[model samples]
Target: MSNRFKNLIVPVLAVVLGMLVGTIIMLVTGYDAGAAFSALFEGAFGDIYYTGETIRQVTPYILAGLAVGFAFKTGLFNIGVEGQLIVGWLASVWVGVAFDLPKIIHLPLAVLAAAAAGALWAFIPGFLKARFRVHEVIVTIMLNYVALHLSNYLIRTVLSEKSDRTPNIHDTASLKSPFLEGLTDYSRLHWGIVIALICVFIMWFILQKTTLGYELKAVGFNQHASEYAGMNVRKNIILSMVISGAFAGLAGAMEGLGTFGYAPVRGGFTGVGFDGIAVALLGGSAPIGIVLAALLFGSLKVGALNMPLEAGVPNELVDIIIALIVFFVGASYMIRIFIERLSKKKGVK
Candidate 1:
C-alpha cells in the first residue's frame, strides 16, 4: 500500500477503535454508550453557539499542533511548548495592556510580542541542543515549571497588583468579533481562527516549496549527512525551533486576545501544548492532517461538556476516549503489520 493511503487509514482506524473501546467500557460499566455519544455529537454541533465554541477551541489546537509538527519535520521534540506558550501569553497581554496605539499597529505589535517571546523561550533549548548536545525534552520539561512560576510572579508583581489577572486588552488589540459573537449567541469566537488557517497554508507552503525547508528536512533525516552535504545543521536546528516556538506563541495569543482578553496567573498548565503532541502524532505531522486532528479533538472537548447534562455520563469519559485514541495511534505500527500480513495472505489465496 502507498504511504499516503497508510497515513490516511491509520488515523481513521484509530478513531474507530477508540470509539469502539469507549463503547465497550461504558457497556461494562452499565452506562448507555449510544445515548452518551448521541449527546456528544449534539453538544458539539447541535446549534450555532456550540459549533462556534468548538471552532474557537480548535483555533489554539491548530496552532499548537503546527508548533509541534513543524519541529517534528526538523527532528526536534519541542516539549517546552507549554513554557513558550505561557511566556507568549504574558508578552501579548503586556503589549496589549501597556500600549495605546492605533488598531493596525497595536494588534500586530501584541501578536508579534507573543511570537517573539515564544521564539526566545524556545531558542534556549535549541541553542543548548545544538551547542552541547543537550536533550531538548529534559530542558523543555524543566522550563515548563519555570514558566508557570515566572508568569505567576510577573502577573502578581508587574502586571497587576490588585488581582491575579491583568486588565483587559484594549479594543484595538483584541481579536474578538461582535459579528461572530452575535452569530453564535455570544460565544467567544474570534478572528484568531482566520490566523490559524493562514498558518496552516503557510506551513504547507514552506515545507513543500522552500529551500530552507529542504535543508531542515535533510538535517532531520540525518544530521551528519546533512552537515557533510554542506548544510548548516546547527543553524537549521535553531531556526526550526524558533519557528515552532513562534507558532506556539501564536497559540497563546489566540487564548489571550481572542478567548480571554487578559492574562491570568495560571495555577497549572493550560494543557493545550501537551495535547498538541498527541495531535501532531495522530495527524502524522502533516499540515492538513493536523487541522483535521485539531477539529476532532476540539469537537470531543466541547461535546464532553454535554455528557453530564444529556446522558448522565461524566465528561471525563471523553478524556479516556481521547487517551485510547492516542494509544491506538502510538500502536499504529502493529496495525500496519497486521494489514500487511492480511494483504499477503489474500494474495496467496
Candidate 2:
C-alpha cells in the first residue's frame, strides 16, 4: 500500500480496535454494551444540540493538536504546550477584561495578546535548545508547572474580581454562537471552529508549500544533515517552537474569549494541552488528520457526560476508550502486521 493509504488505514483500524475493546470492557462490567453505545451516539450526534456541543468541545482540541502536530513535523517534542496555553489564556483574559474598547478592537487585541504570550512562553525553551543545547522536552515540562502556578497567582491576586474570576469581558470581546438561537438550547459553539479550520489549512500550506517549512522539517529529520546542507538548523528549531506555542495560545484563548467570557481561576491543570499529545498521535500528526481526531475526541467527551445519565455507564469509560485508542495508534506496527497477515490469508492469486 502507498504511504498515504497506510496512514489512513492505521488510524481507522486503531479506532475500530479501540471500540471493540471498549465494548468488551463494557460487557465485562455487566453493562449493556449496545445500549451504552447507542446512548453515546445519540448524545454525540443524535440532535443538533449535541452536535454543536461536540464541535465546541473539539475547537480547542484542534488548536492544541495542531500545536503538537506542527512541532512533531519539525522533529521537536514540545511538552510545554500546557505552559504556553496557560500564558495565552492569562494574557487574553487580562486584555479582555481590563480594556473597555469597542468589540472590534478589543477582541482582536485580546487575540493578538494571546498569540504573543504563547510565542514568548515558547521562546524560552527554543532559545535554550538552540543556543545551549538544552533539551526542549525537559525545559517545556518544567515550564508547565511554572505557568500553572503563575497563572493561578495572577488570577487570584492580581486580576481577581469579587468572585474568583475576572469580570465578564467587554461585549465586543465575546464570541457569541450565531447558530445557538437556531439550534439546541445554548451551545457554546462559536466562530472559533472556523478559525481552527483556517489554521489547519494554513499549517498544511506552510508544511507542504513553503521554504521555511522545508527548513524546519529538514532540521527535524536531522539537524546535522540540515546544517551541512546549508539550512539554518538553529533558526528553524527556534521558529518551530514559536509557531507551536502560538497555536497553543490560540487554543487557550478560544476557551476564554469564545466560551467562558471571563477568565475563571484555574484551580488546577486543564487537560486540554496534555490531551493534544493524544490527539496528535491519533491524527498521525497530519493537518487534516488532526482535525478529524479532535472532532472524535470532542464527541467522546460530550457524549461521555451523557453516559451516566442516559446509559447508566460511568463517564470514565470514555477515558478508558480514549486511552486504548491512543495506545493502539502509538503501537500501530502490530495492527499493520495483522493487516498484512489477513491480506495474505485472503490471497486471490
Candidate 3:
C-alpha cells in the first residue's frame, strides 16, 4: 500500500473498533445500541440547528487541537494549554467590554488581545525551559492552577458585585453573526468557525512550507544535532510554545466572542484543553489530521447530548465510547501491523 493510503487506514480502523466496542458495551448493559447510535447521529446532523451546533462545537476543538499538536511537533508537552485558554478567555472578554470602537477595530483588537494573553501566559513556561532546562510539563501544570486562581481574583476585583461573569461585550466586539445565526435557525454558530478553518490552512502552510517550522521540527527530533548544525534550539523551543499558546488562546476567544459574548470565571479548568491532547495524539499531530480528529470528537460530544434525552441511554455511555476511541487510537500500532501483514499477503507492492 502507498504511504498516503496506509496513513488513512489506521485511524479509520481505530474508529471502527471504538464504535464496535461501544456497541458491545451497550448490549451488555441492556441499552439498545442501535437506538443510541441513531439518536447520536440525529442529534449531530438532524437539522440546521443540530448541524450549526455541531459546527460550533467543532470550532474550538480544532483550534485547541492545533495548539497541542503544534507544541508536540516541537517536542514540547504543553500541559498548560488549559491555563492559557483561561487567561485568553478573560483577556478577550475584558478587551471586548472595555472597548468602544468600530466593529472591525473592536473585534480584531479583542481577538489580538486574546492571542497575546495566551502567548504571554505560555511564555513563562517557555522562559523557564529555555533559561534553566526546566521541564515544560511541570511548569505548565502548576501555571494552570495559577491561571485559574488569578482569573478568579481578577474577576472578583474588577467586576465585583457583578457575579462571576463580565458584562456582555458590545456589539462591535461580539463575534455573533445574526445573518449566520438566522441561516442556521438561531443556533449559536458564529464567525469563529471561519477563523478556525483559516488557521488550519495557516498551520499546514507554516509547518510544511516554512524554514522556521523546519528548524523547530529539527530541534524537536534531535536538539543536540540541531544545535551542532548551528540552529538556535532554545529559541525554537520558546517560539513553538508561544505559537501553541496563541492557538489555544484563539479557542478561548471563540467561546468568549462567539458562544457567550462574555466569560464567566471558573473555579476549575475547562476540559477542552485536555481533550485537545487526545485530539492531537489521535491525529498523529498533523494539521489536517488534527482537524479531522477534532470533527470526530466534536460530533460525538454534540451527539451524546441526545442519546440520553431520546434513547434512554445514560450520557456516561458516551464518555465510555470516547474513552474507548482514545484507547484504540493510542493502540493503533496493532492496526498498522495488521494492515501491513495483509498487504504483504496480497503481494501488492
Candidate 4:
C-alpha cells in the first residue's frame, strides 16, 4: 500500500477500535450498547434541530482545533489556548455590549477585537520562550489559571448584568442566521460555522502556499538551521503563537456572539480548549482532518445527552468513549504497525 493509503487507514482503524472497546464497556455495565448508540445517532442527526445543534457545537471545536493544529505544525505546544479563548470571549463581549454600529461593521469589529485579545494573550508565552528561554508548556499552563481568574473578576465587577453574565449584545453585533432559523426551527447555529470554514481555508492556503509558513515550519523543525538560512527564528516563533491564539480567540467569539449573545460567568474553565487538543490529535493536525474530527466530537457531545434520557445510560459514558478515541488516536503508530504487518503477510501469500 502507498504511504498515503496507510496514513488514511490508521485513523479509520483507530476509530473502529475505539468504538469496539466502548461497546465492550457498555456491555460490561449491563446497558444495551446498541440502544445507546442508536440513541446517540438519533439525537445527533435524526432531525433538523439535532443536526443544527451538532453544527453549533462543532463551530468552536473547528477553531480550537485549528489553533492547536497550527501550533503543532510549527513544533509548538500551545497549552494556553484556554487562556487565549477566555481573553477573546471577554474582549468580544466587551465590544459587543458597548457598541451600536450597523450589523455589517459591528459584527466584524467584535470578531477582530476577539482575535486581537487572543493574540495578545498568546504573545506573553511566545515572548517568554523566544527571549527569556522559558518553557512554553509551563508558561501556558500557568496562564490558563490567570485568564480564568481575571475573566471571572471582570465579569463580576465590570461586565456583570442582573444575572451572572455580561450585558446582552446589540442585535447588530449578534451573528444570527435567519436562514438556519428557517431551516432548523431557530436553532442557535449561525454564521460562525461559515467563519470557521473560511479560517480553515485560509490556514490551509498559508501553510501550503506561503513563504511565511515555510519559514515557520523550518524554525519548528530546527531553529539553528532556520537561523543559518537567514530566517528570523525568533520572529517566526512569536508569530506562530500569535496566530494560534487568534484562532483560539475566534473559538470563544463563536460562543459569545453566535450562540450565547453574551459572556456568561464561567464558574470554571470551559473545556473547549482542552478538547481542542483531542480534536487536533484525531485530525492529525491537518486542516481537512481537523474539520472532520471536530464534527465527530461535536456529534458525540450532542448525542451523549440523549443516551442518559432515552437509554438509561450514564452521560459520563460518552466521555469515556471520547477518551478512548483520543487514546487510540495517540497510539496510532500501533495501528500503522499492524496494517504494515497485514500488508506484508498478504504480499507473501
Residue-by-residue lDDT tens digits, candidate 2, 209-261: 99998888989999999999999888898999999999999998898888887
* Model 3 ranges with Cα > 4 A deviation: none
lDDT of each: 0.94, 0.89, 0.90, 0.91
lDDT of 1 by residue, 1-349 (tens): 7777888998999999999999999999988999999999999999999999999999999999999999998899999888888899999999999999999999999999999999999999999999999999999999989999999998999999868999999999999999999999999999999999999999888889999999988998999999999999999999999999999999999999989999998879999999999899889889999999999999999999999999999999999999999999999998898778877898899
Worst 10 residues of 4 by lDDT: 156-165
* lDDT per residue as tens, model 4, 1-349: 8998876777777778889999999999899999999999998998899999999999999999999999999989998998899889889989999989999999999999999999999999999989988988999999999999888888888887445788889888888779987798777889899999999998998899999999988999999999999999889989999999999999999988889888887778899999999999888889999999999999999999899888999878889989999989889888888888999999999
Question: Which candidate number maximizes TM-score?
Answer: 1
TM-score of decoy 1: 0.99
Top-lDDT candidate index: 1
Segments of candidate 1 deviating more than 4 angstroms: none
C-alpha TM-scores of all predictions: 0.99, 0.96, 0.96, 0.97
**Which 10 residues in a row give candidate 2 its minimum summed lDDT?**
176-185
lDDT of 3 by residue, 123-161 (tens): 999989988999999999999999889988888779545
